[model samples]
Target: MFAPFAPMLRRAALVPSVHRLLPSNSRSLYQNIIKRHEDMATEHGSPSSSGEMHDALDVLSSESSPISTIPLDPDTDYAALAIPSLQSKNKANLPPLMNIPPQEDPLLHHIASRIMNHGERAKASRTVSQMLLHLHAWTRSPPLPILRQAIFKLSPAVKVIGHKHSTKMIYKPVPLSEKQGIWLATEWILDAIKGRQGGPTLAERMAREVILILKNESKTLEKKEAYHKSAMMNRGNIAIART
Candidate 1:
């Protein structure tokens, strides 16, 4: 009986009671918290923990899917799988091109060609351009119209050419066609300008002649009148000059 009582006392001293370490109210509160934890654990374990974990993994995989399975936002995108672009549709609104070239005046081109010395066409073009610019400076209006007026005033209705009137050749005036009249007028202008004195450049000479013709005092006009006189007197030879 003594041995049993000594062993029982030793055991009771080794183990401490919860009531001694904590107040009665604290001990009751602690018990209530532990009971709530145990009930929650049992409820969660009853519904298969592994099954819930697998369901969560499936949800994550669906959110990160390679193929889209949701409708696109109407404002932000046209379609879910389609690329966004309008490169071709916007281009249709632009104006169409005809691919036509720019054209210069025919008389201007012809004059430039006639002025060309050797194969230096670029130089001749510069000279002609300078001449036109000078005309522009003197007159406030466009130069080409004034130039055409001068050409019309100076171009004779007939040209004198030598024709055989028996064994000897006699000079006779013949009626000139429209094209020939233009050519003869331009030639007279060029010839008159070429024979000038005290002009520094060919462009200046040509400009001065053009201006004089506009004022009705150019040498070209005189030559034109002289030709008309001879043509009038030689009208008798018109029949012979036709051949």
Candidate 2:
């Protein structure tokens, strides 16, 4: 009976000792101590079995009181983070892409062809001048029996007024001064064509002659005003002298 009583007393003492060792919040306190120990071990170069445990602890701590909350810099280069930035740099150096238009027919193709084949410039200018010369005969655009008479008749004529006054006939002379110049230029071009000095083209010669005529007419207009004034003054002087 004394032996059983001693065993029971020992069991009661063991219970009190165990209870003292483990307090009411012992489980939570033990977990915290284990987490702090893991962090210290990691800082000292001791890797954890699974780093997820430390990461979870860190996230929880940060949530409670964040250490940093600022955003990353906008100017921070992500390309620099790559293993080799030369790959991107090389691509940028490549030539730019372009969609070039294809070659087509030129706008002056017809005009150029006429000039090359028929020598239309010299002939056209002469023809136009000849038609203008016969303007009085063909007011109603009648069939002039003289047009089919000869090639020379269809050509330009230079005045016999010597080299200084070699005048060719022009078809469309807007100004009187231009009228004489165009006529002379047309005759010069016609003579060149007949003498084989120039190609048969006439249209270009005609256009050039017409332009020259216009320039001359503009210059002559200035003289025309002076001549009119002088003539008036002369007539007045003559009238006064007679009186």
Candidate 3:
């Protein structure tokens, strides 16, 4: 009975020692495996078994090729992107002078120059000259038939006021010539520029007078058109006068 009990007790004592050795061996094996993985990761430019493979791949790819690492648009214009500041610099470096032709008419050139330099009198003078020149061109050497017709239209009607019952009308023809018409037009323009005797002065009313004189519906322009229309209607007079 004692011998059997002794074997049982020795086996029970060996079981605790085996359990203690098993834990130490398993821990050393696990540490060795972890160290081996770290060494492999260092050699291959990757991370250990810590789940950092994606981050390691990004770093490795960026370090391999720097140009390809940055994302760029396929249609991007690299040259335009590189020197954006040069465009403004080139514009600033251009010469200030411009190419323009000189005015042919001396009076027109003078007026334009003065207007550009903000001369007050130049504008008034220009307006007067322009109106006069236009009127002169239209009225100069008008057909004799047209002149007679215009005069007839302009003739004043004299009404004879009789005492009892009879009433009569007399037409007085106003003599008009192309020279006279041109002279009157010039004088009219001058008066407008100078303003009325009791009205505004040239400095105060020059612009207003200029606008009125140069208008298409002006009295002077209406007179010119009336003359032209009257001439057209009396074309037969032109043939008669030539005879």
Candidate 4:
């Protein structure tokens, strides 16, 4: 009888009616909160847990990539750190020619004057002469020979002051011919004047400043030369009239 009574008491203790039960309101409230949260998630079309986790991982990975890829320490960029020095070294190593000042060719002034004085004739002469100067400067060639060669190349209509008027004496102008020749000539002479070339020394760069000044006076020089020429032509006409 005692054993059966003890077994019944244990069974009663385990049963819900004999136990301290959860309040019905509390249980209902908890269930409602869980269901409401599920409904709200469904209404909002929120991503599932696994999807949310994957998205977060993707974001984290993207943010971390650049930081991990690039070096944090400035010193670690050996190439970047050395770049300024390398550039300086390279600049220093450049040929002394590039650093040289512009050349002072007296011929430039003389040629310029000839151009202004002669107008069409002198202009054409100046153009050809300047082109020749460029060549002479570039090749370090002897002045008179280049001048002679250039004169030979001019059109028959384009005559240097002393060139023969014969058809056999004139040379034709080729297309794209003057372009390269002029470039080479200008750069070469500029280098030579700047002391880059091993040749006969030219006037100092300071003296070259005088040429620039004269270049400004080119307009006045033109008027004087024109007046002189007109007077001479007038005298020639008067002599012819008397005859």
TM-score of model number 4: 0.18
TM-score rank, highest first? 1, 3, 4, 2
TM-score (all chains, Cα) for each model:
0.53, 0.16, 0.23, 0.18
The whole-model C-alpha lDDT of candidate 1 against the native structure comes to 0.74
Candidate 1 RMSD to the real structure? 29.2
Collision count for each candidate, in order: 0, 14, 0, 3
Give the per-residue lDDT of model 1 (tens digit) for 1-243.
588699879876764433345566765666566556556766887545545544543443342424348975678755533433454555767678786754967667778888898988889888888888888898877888877777778789986788886798887888888767778888988998776567468887888888898899887888888988988877776564455
| Shift of residue 108 alpha carbon in model 4, Å | 5.5
lDDT of 3: 0.47
Best by TM-score: 1
Residue 114, model 1: Cα distance from true site in angstroms: 1.5
lDDT of 4 by residue, 1-243 (tens): 588699889976665431134455755565566556667777788748445544543443342322336547755878887999999999988866555544645435443443343356556454545555655565576654644343223212211122234654332222223443333333323443454455432323312322332344322233334434544444422223353
Candidate 1, residue 142: CA error in Å? 0.3
Q: TM-score: which is higher, 1 or 3?
A: 1
Best by lDDT: 1
- Report lDDT (Cα) of residue 84, candidate 4: 98
Candidate 1 lands at a TM-score of: 0.53
Residue 93 deviation, candidate 2, in Å? 99
